[model samples]
Target: MPASALEGIDESTWVDVIQKMDEVYSQLIDDEIELEKKNAELEQSQQFIFSVLSAMSDVLLVCNERGVIEETNAALCELVGRTDAELHGTSLYELLADPLSVERARTVLGNTNPARRGEGLELNLFDAQRQSVPVDANCTPRVAASGRRVGTVFVARPTAEIKRAYHELRSAHEALKRAQQQLLHSEKMASLGRLVAGVAHELNNPISFVLGNVHALSRYSNRLRAYLAAVHAGEPAEQLQALRGKLRIDHILDDLPSLIEGTLEGAQRTADIVNSLKRFSAMDPEDRIPVDLNEVIKRAIHWIGKGAVPDFEMRWQPGPPLMVMGSAGQLQQVLMNLLQNAQDATAAHGKADKLVSIETEVVENCVRLHLRDNGPGIAPEHLSHVFDPFFTTKPVGKGTGLGLSISYGIVEHHGGVLSVCNQIDAGAEFLLELPLAH
Candidate 1:
């Protein structure tokens, strides 16, 4: 009620108005106390936030819309090596490393609209000694309880230690990679030594048998000539004939041809095996030349066929002799290993139309050789370890497990790649890639 309305009111009504005023006054005092309590809580909260900001390792800054520094934490003061009074009124740009970083900071801070947050710019701050200190800054607009934009709040942390750690981590990773490769190379050499020893042992048996047969044949030939001389000399034909009959000369003559042929074949086989071993073992690790990969593949197939014709139907699809820069012997070994594997896989399946296919092509200035077989594919669990040293699916004594591993190393030494995978429909496939020679 207005004071003008009170002038016309009766005394009793005025007294009632006075009582109501007293009640209103008491309520107002209670409201004032509650407001005071809330103000005190707000002040405590502000102090706590300021203390936390001061304690942080990262620099925190409060800037107004005009991009002037309003307040900063102890971190900022320590980084600048200045007192609070010296930094309080300075522009944020003045502390940045360069004009570009200054411009970026200004642009980010100028956007005071709460909807548009800063882009988290990275800047380097210059210390009192002019040393660079890298920092990443994330800025956002600060707003009051009345929903008005007050200023911008910046949070930044130094990234020098983080970057140093990253570089060290990268170096350690490279060292570990080199160590693993060295271990693999050592294992490959050991396996090759065993292979050589096994081959030598195998060759000794047939060679010894051949030598014995040759000595026996020489003695038998001498005996036959001497007996013929006795018949020609007037020594009694009947006696000589009787001796010949006793010696079974007729049977000897009949079987000699086969014996000679068998001996020749054994010798030839030993030679072939030796030749293949020579090709495999005569590799010069440092020698690289422009080689015809198609020729290498053909030679590998021929050598593999000479040992024993594979049970599988072998198909060779040779393209115009693709040239690549690599070690011929090592590449040939790689081809032989793959082809041998394909042959064994297809033979084991014992399926009709068992085919081992070798195909070559020139694609994208690289030669690609693909060997595939129609047989049981590699087991899924074993696929990942197929190229690992001493990993094999063959029964013990049937395989040494170093074939593929050595082949892989050989290919890598030649700056090529060897990879294997299960075919889409059936069997497994091996792919070899060699960069084209310039």
Candidate 2:
């Protein structure tokens, strides 16, 4: 073969080599373009996920199998008083105030032995100050791409307001207790005053009669003495005997017994006034078993204190063991009325004398309790109608006027009575009568 012909014969090899190089270059370019597109898509997806997490206001946290924080949103920063960078990698145990909180959340997430127990759990968290804060927490076990449990995702919200609601309820309860106390005190005072005043007035008559008899006895005794003196002076027998007869000395002497009885009766009448007062106001209601009047009274005051009434000035007079038979509840109602009245009366008027006085004493199987207020005295005209139903000195809508009336009814039901009085000084008073325990 000629050399020129051979050279020309290499055309096939050159074409093949050129064709191979072009094909390889084309493939490389295509692969590079596909790789660039994939990288861009991945970056966009990452940006979208980050944006979603950062926009959320609620705290979201992710932890690894070891309970170490792997990811935290912007919200975690505000929740823990730290930045997301600071929160990441932090152990869940370190982030939580109580390790049990996390345990409880695990249970709620159905990670416990029985699994699938419930949805979520409410937890009370203690702040640095150890104050309770209500929080609702939920979690779910996280799975890796391989379908193995990796960690958990937790979301939480502060429940401080819920705890505040509970506290408010407790406060309301205390207020109720104070109100109950005041009502009982008022009732007792009102009932006692009425009965005592009536009985005292009635006893005056007997006392007067007894006093009259005593005066007569003394006069007769004087005459008998005079007659005897004449005899001792050695007067003529007829004259001495005449004097004795005219003086009625024998009759006078014989009448001494009657005279003494009259005096005793009069003194007894006076005593009856006080005794009746004691009986009327004594703390011995027929409806009740024995109870400590003092303790009951205290409860009444506490109940009333919760209202607009300011701190009351309470004066308790210690007396002999003041146990009485009365319905504690009803009696408490009465006392509540009286105490509220006193506080209200004083409240508008600036709590004059600034004192609420309580006294107890025992007399004749009854206990006498005096509930006195150093408030402005009741007007003379109003005193008579104070106990009347629907009669109130307070402005309209301020009171029902039934406070005293209902108290009166309660006392009556217990076989006792209630009343009020104007003190000689500037104040009003109420007395209660109840039966003494045998």
Candidate 3:
């Protein structure tokens, strides 16, 4: 029967049948190859996604509309002490540490809107040891390709970790602030060191006057004691008068008052100088007080002038008291820095008549102090960087370069502005402006 069936089919028909079968087989082979390639790509994608989820530090969960856990990352699995198989198909609410968290989770997961996103919800969950761990959780609605809401995706970070990070950041900030303050104090002390010579000279005048007055008073005391002893010895009045004339008692009595007054003045002056030095050398207090800029300028000039060369002169006509709110020591430091810089500039230029002139005026609600020097003007390229830290025109050991920089910062802290420029004629002028105290 099979031979009879084959005999009815012609050879060409059989050839066509064999060729169609070969074509069909070839097509099937190609399809199989394409399917293998697609399978390989899918496997690679799954591995990549798994690796990403495993590497993430935050806890991740994917749940269906019923709050049934469908997928979870390694972090979540490890946190709850469960395997992927155990976590799958479990109710997400079962892992919540409290009823409040369960209610919150239900509310977040129940929202079916595709555009809804829940963020920064503090939820507590049970860890492997059944201990509560607070987390900052974010929930976003998961949507299907057909635009239908299917489930929710949750990502959470531990609050303890975030708090630790914030604490560390605050500590670093405080440390940096302390370091900056120390640097400022170091620069201030360095400036004070440069004024030692001037301070010594300033102290010498008052101290020497006081000593001279004290010596004279001692001699007068001895003469008075001798005269009194003679009078008390019951000597005759003529003899006592002769003794008084010999000892110059009348002159001593007249000069005693003047000597005492001068001594007191000298002592007071010394005390004032010492107090100024103490204020300048001490750390600036945070409290601000009304300071007279004119007085500060005068003191700065007096101190800096004592150390200047014999030919150097500072001309200042203080008009009135310009009251500003700031640390007096800081303002004095700024003025001293300006004056010193002026003196240095003039001396460097080899000016025979070295002079620094200062003027103060009220402009609007601010006080402006202008200090000008007679010297070679600042270089065009150097003017812009004069207030930069570690920028100086003097020789290596002659300057620290922090003077103007620190002074600039001090003025700024006192609500002031300090700037420098080359005078049109020939010199450098510094302009300082500070707000007036109410």
Evaluate all candidate structures by whole-model CA lDDT and list the values in order. Answer: 0.80, 0.72, 0.86
**Candidate 2 runs further than 4 Å off:** 1-77, 84-91, 102-172, 229-438
In candidate 1, what are the lDDT values of residues 1-438, reduced to their tens digit? 788966867899878989999999999999999999999999999999889978999888888777678999899888878877888877777788887788887776665444545558788898767787988888888887998887788889888878899999999999999999999999988888876676676567667777877887787787688788887787887898887887667767886887787688668767865654454443564687889988898899888988896677788877777998877777787888888888888878889889988888878978888898999989999999888655678974355456787787777766778899999998999999888988
- Model 1: pairs clashing at backbone N, Cα or C within 3 Å: none
Task: Give the best candidate by TM-score.
Answer: 3
lDDT of 3 by residue, 303-398 (tens): 886785435787988877899998887889889988888888888889788989999899899999999999897899998988865577787336
Q: Given candidate 1, what's the lDDT at residue 201?
A: 63
Candidate 2 Cα RMSD after full superposition onto the native fold (Å): 19.9
RMSD for all candidates, in order, please: 11.3, 19.9, 9.4
Q: What lDDT does model 3 reach?
A: 0.86
Name the Cα RMSD for model 3. 9.4
What lDDT tens digits, residue by residue, belong to model 2 across residues 344-389? 7766668445788888877797778888887887899998887765
